[model samples]
Target: MSATVAAILVLAVGTYAFRLVGPVLHGRVELPARLQELLAAGAVVLLVALLATGALTEGGAFAGWARPVGVLVGGVLAWRRAPFLVVVLGAAATTAGLRAVGVA
Candidate 1:
């Protein structure tokens, strides 16, 4: 196999093994309540960090005000429990409108 294919196979197997480890060890390892709560909070923080990074940067630089404002509109709709379609469309429209007016 080509080097790239071999590397992909190795990564796929490694990912599967890591996934299997969780199910295999489930119920066998008991985590402390505080640790569990911290883990949950960590997951939320990680997601928010990812969202911010994606929204605020492009090519290692600022993505411009348009993208972040679009994200904010979507976030507000989501927080208000808007439907998924409305959230996505609202963000897209906000970004497109701003770009149309040369905000970026």
Candidate 2:
């Protein structure tokens, strides 16, 4: 398998193994509420971090001005209940305009 696939499999299997271990080791599954809360919070944190990592980065740097402007254009168009094509056009238009004007 490719390194990326192997890494993904390892991570997935390791996570499942650890999660399953809790129940297997302790037949009486009675964890405190706080621990559960922390785990849930950690999951949310991980999700947010993953999203931010993609939405807030580009080409080895932060997402920078043009990308956010494109996203905002798309969002505004979407907020106005524009169609999918219009929203995509809005983002494309915004990105093209910004780049033409050297906003990046």
Candidate 3:
């Protein structure tokens, strides 16, 4: 097999193993309450970091104001409990409108 294919196979197996580990250890391992809370907070932090990275950067540089503003609009709508479709459309429209007006 080609190196790329081999690498993909390895990664697939690794992902499957990781998925298997949760169910296999579910009842056998008990985490402290504080640890659980910390884990949940860590997950939120990681997700926010990922969102910020994707929204604010493109190809290792700033993605300009349009994309981030779009993301912010989407975020506000989501926080307001708007429907998912509306949130998506709002963000896309905000970005497209800004781009159309030569904002970026």
**Candidate 1, residue 48: how far the Cα is off, in Å:** 1.0
lDDT of predicted model 1: 0.99
- Where does model 2 exceed 4 Å of error? 1-52
Q: Following a full C-alpha superposition, what root-mean-square deviation does model 1 have from the true structure?
A: 2.2
- lDDT, candidate 1, residue 58? 100
Clashes per candidate, residues 3 or more apart or on different chains: 0, 0, 0
Which runs of model 3 end up more than 4 angstroms from their true locations? Answer: 1-14
* Best of the two (1, 2) by TM-score: 1
Could you estimate the TM-score for every candidate? 0.85, 0.50, 0.84
lDDT to native, each model: 0.99, 0.85, 0.98
Which lDDT tens digits does candidate 2 get at residues 9-100? 99999999999998788957777999989999999999868756765688778877777788778878989999999999989899889988
Poorest stretch of ten by lDDT in candidate 1: 95-104
Ranking by TM-score: 1, 3, 2
Arrange candidates by lDDT, descending: 1, 3, 2
lDDT of candidate 3 over 54-73, digit per residue (tens): 99999999999999999999
